[model samples]
Target: MQKLFSLTLFLFTFSLSQAQNKFGNPEVDPVQIQKTYEQWSVYQNKNIMLSRDFTALDVSSKEITKEVFLDQLANGSFIPIRLKSDASVYYYKLFKIQPKTDTSIKATINQIGFDAYKNYKMEGTVFPKFSFKDLDGNLVTNESMKGKIIVIKCWYIHCTPCIKEFPQVNKLVEEYKDRKDIIFISLAEDSPEELKTFLARKPLSYAVIPDMKEYMNEALQLNSFPTHFILNKKGLISKVLPNFESLEVALAKESKF
Candidate 1:
């Protein structure tokens, strides 16, 4: 079975040779390859600590095949991305009859979460202080944010989940659009021009701030995409929403404060 699986994989990689490299040794057991993929899935959802350097050592731990695959996937050398309406999916383009497509194969490679940092346990802590000029050059500061319920969302133009969640975020902005006590701010890693182009096609009413990746990394220690922070009236961090699904629940908790 292992020899047959290896032969199958070789034939598949041969077809995509122009696009990707062989991810594993031909002699490598198919069972081990499958295990490597499974380990990557587990790391993405749970054990991944993005605050540290993201490397093969960080991703696969002791598994050699997993490490090689993780490196190739990160560098876009082996996998091809498929964008779907519901979620962005990845497939082993070079590996034939592999686990992602075959249930019997048991090897799975899903969308990796390099920036899926969930270390924001600072709910009761004071929100980190900073100021930046919005896209319109309006100076936004923690001082200005004080005495108001500040909604801060961290996103980038290339983030699929971030883009998908924009409509709901916009609705949340509209619900409180009439109120001066509530402020909506988005901190993006994109430049002002990139944001301008994206927002032209898909408008977001929030006060969009650009070039905030450094602030996110240094101040917030965020290693993930689409993180939302809610600062209460006192400017203390009230709730931190990690993904789009947490928006409503985070808002519910914020409503009481």
Candidate 2:
């Protein structure tokens, strides 16, 4: 996965007192949270602390409340934070606030909690039964996907990270072009017309299904865009990954190809 941050700490450097003065109730503004995430690369692994005023969205694109956020600090949630200096880098994990008195809190990543969360939410669970028609009018469903390894990507036309991974995902499809037992597919939130226009400029190799907002939200209950789910031969989800690199690794392991 690409590290989403630069080494320039001065850009984000701020005083705790300064943050305290500006602190306010957590607002459910997806646009503002997204803008902040884009500017700071909030999901990156870094040795830094976020100010109390920092806003973060949950997987569903909803901003977490201050009270709930503080509760989750002691409990566990899939939020962005860094682990110990020696530990393997993790982007989103169960994080605890350090130095309780400070307005700027150091996030301590809890690897075990993260693993448990993944296991409960993704691994070993059957992929929800879905029926979708691609741009070519080909119908695909869970029944059709059984007996084959499936790699599914959920994304929208305007999501920057989703668009950024197109080239690499196309390469992934090309790499397995000859494989008969595996399938690559994408569920896009845009309409077929929009997708057709976009793909004409930036092509993708996966069988693209458009206008999948309902399925992506209701069936998958996904909180983030550009999420990848790898399913085994039995249609059981083997992994839920944030990036194509991680998806590739999961695919290789599941398919043994």
Candidate 3:
């Protein structure tokens, strides 16, 4: 099924970069260290070639193969966020080794810094206006959101983390359902039929709009999956949370009731 395919892709992508082996020495300044995250390829029967961004950390073995690196990471030999200084090093493991042509293999790795994503505090900034039809064919726009605390979530059916947090999001919606001034809306990246089928098996309490990816991306400039935007009654952006847990905390503090 299409839904199953989406779920599989999400899991594969999440696990793919978590298998890479990259370690930073705590004794060195983070700025002095290089190759926090990199992609690599191996050609011929020779040596592994890392991308320009990568400089190998001094590890136990310098002659280890990519497979060996992955195996060690999977076996818990290397841990994420190993070194801390001005920058925190989180090594995303190499999850795959795919042969390209005859004599080459490509590998992917991610290096995330402690401040990779700086949380945006857009409070007092005017919320942008965008329109999309909810599942019930009701038009949802900034005008519709006026005089209310608007909670808008940008999500898709295939995102595992988004689905994992759906229950908590649903609970939050249920808790504020009775309040006329608080509205929870989900702009899903799926078509209406897809959402209908998916929701039949896994239901959510928020007002869901299907096939709103275009408007969500172009109008709201939201590209991140499972992003939440909270707007106050004055239509000002109050909080922009990347996950439902943070949204829950924001809701509690800025409750409209």
Winning model by lDDT: 2
TM-score of predicted model 3? Answer: 0.54
TM-score for every candidate vs. truth? 0.55, 0.61, 0.54
lDDT of each: 0.61, 0.63, 0.59
Q: After superposition, how far is residue 155 of candidate 2 from its true place, in Å?
A: 0.3
Candidate 1 residues lying further than 4 Å off, grouped into runs, are 1-120
Better of 1 and 2 by lDDT: 2
What TM-score, to 2 decimals, does candidate 2 have?
Answer: 0.61
- How far out, in Å, is residue 49 in model 2? 20
* Selected candidate, larger lDDT, 1 vs 3: 1
Model 2 weakest 10-residue run by lDDT: 84-93
Off by over 4 Å in 2: 1-97, 100-120
lDDT of 3 by residue, 1-257 (tens): 99999999999876644433224333333222222322122111112212111222324313344334434433422322123223322222222222221121111222111111222424558876777788989898888788899998889999998888888898888888778889888989899999999999999888899987787778666656777888899899877776776687678768934
Best by TM-score: 2
RMSD of each: 13.8, 14.4, 18.0
Tens digit of per-residue lDDT, candidate 2, span 70-132: 345435533443322223322222322323322222223233233324433567798888888
The reply for model 3, stretches above 4 Å from the true place, is: 1-121
